[model samples]
Target chain A: MNARARLLVFALGALLLGGAYMAALSQLAPLGRGASAYADILNRVCVRERHITDVVTAVNFDYRGFDTLGEEFIMFTAVMGAVLLLRRGKDEVQAPQEDELTSRRGRRRSDAVALAGVVFTAVLLLFGSYVITHGQLTPGGGFQGGVIASTALWLVYLSGSYKVMRQVGPKPLVEAAEALGAAGYALVGLIGLFQGAAFLQNTLPPGSIGSPFSGGTVPLIDIAVGLEVSGGFVLLLLTFMEEVLEIRLH
Target chain B: MLNIFCYSIAAWVLLIGLYGVVTSRNLIHLVLCLSVMETSTYVLLTLIGYRVGGTAPVFADIPVGTKAVDPVVQALMLTDVVVEATVMALLLALAVQAHKRTGSLDPHDLRALQG
Candidate 1:
């Protein structure tokens, strides 16, 4: 058999083996469809007593909040690492002349592309704000919204040049926002401790459930986390793009 | 019905991502493929939590709600999206830097530190 066919056959065999392994594991499950107590809890309890919204938010900011905190830290670390590793070395910065890299050749975008970019960036900014603000009430929340907001800058980058990206993404501004966002995230956890609850406890009033401000510390945490993430990702991407572009100063 | 659609789409997204990873020659494309792969997991998790035609899991909708999706999955996916973006950003940056020094987008040519 030819190399390609051999590879395909090997892959198919592996997939079948994996499926069999998973099926075997499935047989090990308890012989019940659902938990008896959980079903009882679902059926016997009144809706208010069940308190689904509060339960969710509580779990979010409390039970698994440490995981959320760690996620924010991961973003922070990734961005910082990117900046440190790809930053222009002093030698590269001082080099007399560097060869220009190949990218897109002479393809200048039409004005319509530029206009669409501007419109899309605006829509992303507004949508991100909406997502963050209405996080408690909707599926989209702070982190998702924040990434969306930050990626809007890439739209700007694609529209114009590195200069436009740099103008909006100065190192100091992004760094400060990132730092503040982290501090804010930590403070949310601390608030629970201050209120005699465990760390990252959902201590704040849950408020009226459907209100924009109902999720208590969750919304605040979401916004803080969003800001930090957006700032971080933008910095990381731009730093890399600039390195690739290998801009040389006169 | 929506759940089945969600599941099918999730599978499709994952397959498309795998295809990208397998076929891509450019470093940027590989990084983007990884992002797409991560996104498929997001879709799968979110769909698993979804109740068909369910309202948002808030008090306003809870009164008339038949079932609610899992908020934990939503929160988890939200965090994952941020993490993915950050990681993708870093990967793209590294790819750019590698290109600058060695001058190529193809991964096969990036053997700069080989001793």
Candidate 2:
């Protein structure tokens, strides 16, 4: 259709949407005691008496921990597959040197940025550890913390070169960490089985509600997840930047 | 009405993604669009399952007052987000390889891989 027709159609659609939203709002019960009554009921019957964070922890680590395991593996395999697919052949020429190493257009980083990146990497490392350790009690968790950790290398890469990234981002070390993380996750489930509980079931003592180590298997799993996620994301990004972005080391 | 809102948003996302996949010459754009579509559906699904004015599932502090929102959907979304992220990363990697092999980012140029 012509542009005018398209504009008319868009306007009509917006009008219809506005009308529908108004109708829905009219149907919705007014916000008052009735609307919040559910919250009051929960407070009196359940939440006011029990600790909400503990239950969230249990659900995340125990009840549905198996799913988290699978999620971690998904990340792990993606990184592995990316690396495998993107590896350069032995005879392939090393990417020729570029002048602007710090360009955001791709992975190219300037020398000055590379120097500053080392400092940023240290910050990310500390922040990531803090997130993973406090995951059980805070809004941040292993997965989020792991990504933050992995992103530390981007600065390192930007500041200097892939050499810097490789030195600190050692693939062998990352691989070992990934493997251990996976094993730790599995071991947690095995412990549950050995205790005669369901697989991935929380058998460890929950400790006190607000304590750092209070969430039993949740904190342990969080640590494992943190490692796996960080390793996986870094690996994936490295593979892509190396292969697709074609950032040369020399 | 809420269902309609959720479904419409889901449809809009899917259609926009479909358009991007079909019309975009760049492989990376296609993957990005696909992620956008996936995110839209996730939001729709979460909204469909949400209890209006419902709180998160967990009775950590209360004896037993509020009915918990569906933990199943929240848990599933967590898994879904991770899976989608993995898939997108892999797709981007493949797109890179395709670019390297063909010296082009257009999907129309990638015929060697096809039977």
Candidate 3:
């Protein structure tokens, strides 16, 4: 359709949607109530049963473990798909002439900027680890922490070069870590099965609430997810950067 | 009411995102519009779970009787955010490949399969 016609259709759709939403909002009950039916049960039993002060983490890693498992796999599959789609083709060849072009365009880095990047990356790595490990007790969790940690790798790339990144961690090792992380999540779930509980059942002891070592298997799952996410993201970045650099892949 | 205001803002965001997506010409712009749509949904979900006087759900220093905001929606939103990131990554990757093969980023210009 033409631009005018498309705009008219979109405007009409928006009007209808907005009207429906306002009508629904008017009919809804007032907010600021106590626990919902679902939240009520969670509040009543989650702390005592799982010994986790963070109900969100408990719900994510324990109460709704299966769903979290599926979410992790979704990420794993997406990363794999990206790798497969972005793979270097057999017909493509890298020439040394591109290096000259890149070098000519490359700008000199300042010493201060490089130093700041290194310092910030170290701090980010530390903070990310703290976030992942403290997930059971705090607001941040595996996914958030993992993404933060992955930024450190990006910082290294930004401050230096692709060659520096490769020296920091080889492709095979990073890829292996990603696979291991995904597999480790499943392995943790299988442990519950072997212990006579259903899949992903938190059979380990739910230690004291509000402690670092509490939450039974929740922390373990968080660590596994953290590993998987960090590895997957770093690998994704590495692959994309390689493509940009026209690096050969065999 | 404050709740109504929050909901209306979210609705506006959603509508704006929809409008952007419908009118977007470049593939990159379309992906960004999609992200805006996702953000609207996140805002709606978080606002729906908000309690006027509720504290954070953590029990670290709060009294047992203190009311807390809904944790279920927060957990769901967390998952949604991660999914959004990965989805955007894959979409951008596809856009890159399309640019490589078609030599164009505009949807109207990509007619390789029209025949």
Candidate 4:
């Protein structure tokens, strides 16, 4: 169908869908008044039970850890698919990747900008590590910190070059780290199984509340997730970058 | 009345995203429209989990018995976000393949699937 006709059709269907959606919305509790009894109990108990100051992390990495395992694999598989799809075919050459703009224009990069980028890269790396480690105590965790840390790779690329980014995050090393991260999570859960408890059960010392090591395996899982997520994203960035640079060679 | 306004905003954003998806010509634009649609869920989920006088569910600095919003939905929101990102990446990869094979990003140009 043509664009105009398709939009017209969409409008008619949307009206009905919107009506049904609004009806469903009306049934949900009002904003700021949702009395979720289960969450209330969970929030109240996570501190005493799991020593997790961040109740959300407790839910993600503890109470609902099994689901999180499945979630992690979904990401791993999807990223793997992306890598497969974006890989260079047999016909593609093994030439070095260079910035077409800089090479063609022959312009020099600014020293000040390069220095600032490097500084920012270091700062981001530090902050990301802090976030990942303090997941059980603070609002940030693996998912958030991992993405932030992965940004460091691009910062290095911007300041120096793509080759430097690749050097900073070597492909085989990153891929192995991603695999290890994925495996680490499962292995961490196996600690419980080996102890005759359920899989992913929190069996370690809960430690004193409010401390960094208080949440036992929760923080451990967060570190593994941090590794996997950052490694996966860096791999994605590398794949796309390679594709872009290779295409420019033509 | 105020409650209706917040939920209405979420609903409207969802509709807009859906509209964008149907009208999108390019595959990348369609992928972005999907992201926009996923954003509406974040809004709706946060709204559903909010409490009138409650704070974040953390107890790091605060004492026990303090009122807090639902952490369950927030945890689920993280799941939602991860799923959305991975799906978007997969879709973009598909878009790259489609462009390479068909030499066109426009969905309308390629109506029939040969493979």
Which candidate has the top score in TM-score? 4
Residue pairs clashing, model 3: none
What order do candidates take by lDDT, descending? 4, 3, 1, 2
Put down candidate 2 lDDT per residue, A41-85, tens digits, no spaces: 433432223232533434456566887787777777876777777
lDDT of 4 by residue, B24-73 (tens): 88999999988998898899989999998999999999987899999998
What interface RMSD does candidate 2 have? 7.1
lDDT per residue (tens digit) for residues A1-250 in model 1: 4547755865685466545644543443222221233323332232244222433433444457788898888888888877887866655652312222221336766789889999999999999888777765655666767778887998987776556666777768988888888889899889989999888777787666567777667878878877887778777766666655654433
Angstrom error of the Cα, residue A152, model 2: value is 1.5
TM for every model, in the order presented, reads: 0.73, 0.75, 0.93, 0.95
- For lDDT, the strongest prediction is 4
Docking class of 2: acceptable
TM-score, model 4, chain B versus true chain B: 0.96
Clashes of each: 0, 33, 0, 0
- Residue A155 accuracy (lDDT) in model 4: 88
List per-prediction Cα lDDT, in the order shown.
Answer: 0.66, 0.66, 0.81, 0.86
TM-scores for chain A over all candidates: 0.76, 0.69, 0.89, 0.93
Candidate 3 chain A: minimum summed lDDT over ten consecutive residues — where?
Answer: A95-104
Candidate 2 chain A — worst ten consecutive residues by lDDT sum? A43-52
Model 1 regions more than 4 Å off: A1-13, A20-59, A94-124, A155-165, A246-250, B1-25, B50-59, B62-65, B101-115
